[model samples]
Target: MSEPTNLPVDPEPIREILKNHQQQIRLGLRMCAHCGLCADSCFLYRANDRAPEYMPSYKFLNSIGVLFKKKGKVGKPAVEEMGALVFENCVLCTRCYCPFGIDIPALITLGRRACRSQGVFRAYDK
Candidate 1:
């Protein structure tokens, strides 16, 4: 595995994307309740069977929590990390469901969209 290189670019465009999709992002966050029922539906949790951090709600909370704490003043690095966790790891399969009938995968999709707006999407595969 090689170390990742940071790309040089202004984040203004990315910030605009995030700003444009703010409503959808907020909707996704509002759907979660930290119920933990979705834990069993996660592939990471099922595969490892040891790490609670693999749960979808936990992952979403960590990323979205940063936005809340900072009052939506996140920088590129923060958005990038959130994108990796929510997009790459979770699979966006909608298998994780809460007791209140919340769909975790859908919420993750919203997170990805928010991250994507900030140019936090994965690099193109060559």
Candidate 2:
């Protein structure tokens, strides 16, 4: 029920969060073979007719992956876009399967944190 903020992105906290989890994020991003093996494990993917964008790895790549790639220097619009991917698109069901055991939910959670750091999040009506 909270409203999204228009405040600009702050590099310090965002970088700090990324820095704390840099190793994990880097490994997840780099080790992802993009082979689509994890697709079947995602309910979103299966329920959405196996769309590529709904795949667990795809979500990670687009959300947290982008954050790491940009070194947490993304703008408000980028953060808002990530808000959709991480908060709206993902329910954090934690059912995603990865052959490499990439901990997809944790990565998505990181994405949520990154978005919140920029004052972007899901808004609900009361």
TM-score for each model: 0.68, 0.90
lDDT of 1 by residue, 1-126 (tens): 112436543445545544665665466568666667788877788897747667888776666545544555766667777877876677777677677655566556656765665557666563
Candidate 1 Cα errors over 4 Å, as ranges: 1-33, 124-126
lDDT of 2 at 119: 74
lDDT of 1 at 7: 53
User: What's the lDDT for all of these models?
Assistant: 0.64, 0.85
Worst 10 residues of 1 by lDDT: 1-10
